[model samples]
Target: MLIRLKELRLERGYSMTQAARKIFSHPDTYNRYEKGIREIPLDCLITLAKLYDCSLDYLAGVSDQPRKYGR
Candidate 1:
């Protein structure tokens, strides 16, 4: 899940700072999430899924499919 998050951020051309800003988090905190040092909150995960245009399942590593139907 951490790896996927970093991949998604890179795919979107976002630096850690930029991604953190988008999610209203500090860069260090967001870095912890990407580093697997912190458990991401559910709401934060949902927000990231929305921002990345991917499904929560995908972001959570529960599914490989990125998109949700009707999204």
Candidate 2:
């Protein structure tokens, strides 16, 4: 889960600031979340799931599958 966000962002060629903008977050805040220094909000997680085209379960680390719920 910690790796997923960075992985997805890099795969999409998004810098931290650019990824932050996608979720309406500050770059520092996003970095904190990425580094596990802060707990990410549910809304932000939902936004990231959508942005990465992945499922919350995957981000939550309970699943390895990255597929979204409804394609």
lDDT of each: 0.93, 0.94
Report the alpha-carbon TM-score of model 1 versus the true structure.
0.94
What lDDT tens digits, residue by residue, belong to model 1 across residues 3-67? 89999999999999999999999999999999999999999998898889999889888998888
Model 2: CA > 4 A from native: none
Candidate 2 lDDT, tens digit per residue, 1-71? 88988999999999999999999999999999999999999999999999999999999898888997676
List TM-score per model, in order: 0.94, 0.94
Model 2 weakest 10-residue run by lDDT = 62-71
Model 2, CA-based lDDT: 0.94
At residue 65, candidate 1 shows an lDDT of: 88
User: Which pairs of residues clash in candidate 1, taking residues 3 or more apart in a chain or in different chains?
Assistant: none
